[model samples]
Target: MSKVVFITGASSGIGKSIGLYLHGKNYKVYGTSRNPSKVNVPFSMVALDVTQKESIKRAIGEVIGIEGKIDVLINNAGKGITGPIEDTPTEEMKFNFDTNFFGVIDVIKEVLPSMRLEKSGLIINTTSIAGYMGLPFRGVYSASKGALELVTEALSMEVKSFGVRVVNVAPGDFATNIAAGRYHTPVFENSAYKEKYAENLALMDSHVSSGEDPMMMAKAIYEIIKSKSPKIHYKVGGFMEKFSIILKRVLPDKIYEKLLMNHYKL
Candidate 1:
């Protein structure tokens, strides 16, 4: 039997691409959106709001009911939040963590019981290259995804003996509809960061508009599933985007900060 794969936030964007690609490859793919009925895709679509625990439980139960077990769990559901740290609302940051961090944990916990019982499973987290660094105007998003990356590392060790594997796949920007959905603190007129924040926001949108294809992520994910011993972390993106993570590791704190500031034209 094909492995059962469950993905969150699959209505569109990277999540959609991963789901479609896996379905085409004969994996039993079940993806979730807040309202799955609205989206037409080859894979099964279920309703799941990551921000709601009950929704997560119901979605996982529905999949387990049909498949008996979820061989792979992909935590791709996430929210994007961007603005200067001072200008962005604290509540919005917490909300982002709820979706990008807490929600992911909830989904993983719901699936672990079945996975542990089966003594075999894979959990792949869809984090961001941005998660590796604090990018301008996107600090909250970075924090949320970065936290997930750390959790993936810790969870991998905890579940190793159970025969369940965990990994993080951090993707660079991809052409997607994320910009339209993310919370953007209004460009307050009198605020100190008015001009720069407005400029950076547009730049951010353009980067996504011109980003790499989401199918690349799908293909990378497919390869991981086929591997017998996949690494703890897999990065899928352009050379420079992937290299930036390396640079962060090697460079001094101030120098790295300077490089990012220059890139953002701050």
Candidate 2:
């Protein structure tokens, strides 16, 4: 029997690419969008809003009803927030965490029961290289992905004995529709960070616009699903972005901080 795969945020970008790639490989894929009627994917589409528990429950139930079991669950529904730490409102930070962190948790909770009952499953989370080191203007976005990465690490150990595996796929900048979906906090005309915010926001967008194809990430995900024992974390992106992970681990705190600042032109 073909393994069943479920993915969130599949209306476009990385999530949509992965759903199509896996379905073409005969994985029996189901993808979700906040508005199912708007999704134009070939695979089955489910209406899911991960931040809401009831929506998550309904989506998971629908999948289970048709597939009997979910062999792989991809938590890819997330958006980015940009602003200086002090200028970012509390509500905005909460909104970032709602979709990036808590939403992932809610969906995982709903699917784990079924995965645990079957004694086998794979949970692949989409994290980012920014999660490793807090970015200057995008601190809130960084914090959310960083939190998810830690949860993925801890969850892997907690469910290892149940024949379940959890892993985080941290990609660097990718050419996707993330820019269109990104949320920017309100900035006052006289705010201290006004100038820097404008500069950094453009820089971030440019980097993402010139990033590698989203299909690269889809290929990496496909490989992970085929593996019998995948690593707890996989970094997928350009050479520098992948190497930065190593640099952060081996370099001293102060030195690494300097390098990070220099790289972002802070």
Our model 1 lands, by Cα RMSD against the true structure, at 0.7
Which pairs clash in the backbone of model 2? none
Residue 247 in model 2: shift from native, Å? Answer: 1.2
TM-score of every model versus the real structure:
0.99, 0.98
By TM-score, the best candidate is 1
Model 1, 49-164: lDDT tens digits are: 99999999999999999989999999999989999999898999999999999999999999999999999999999999999999989999999999999999999999999999
lDDT for each residue of candidate 2 in 150-248, tens digit (9 for 90 to 100): 999999999999999999999999999898898886666989988878888889889999999999999999999999989999999999999988988
lDDT of 2: 0.93
Q: Pick the candidate with the highest lDDT.
A: 1
TM-score of 1: 0.99
Kindly report which residue stretches of model 1 are placed more than 4 angstroms away from their true locations once superposed: none
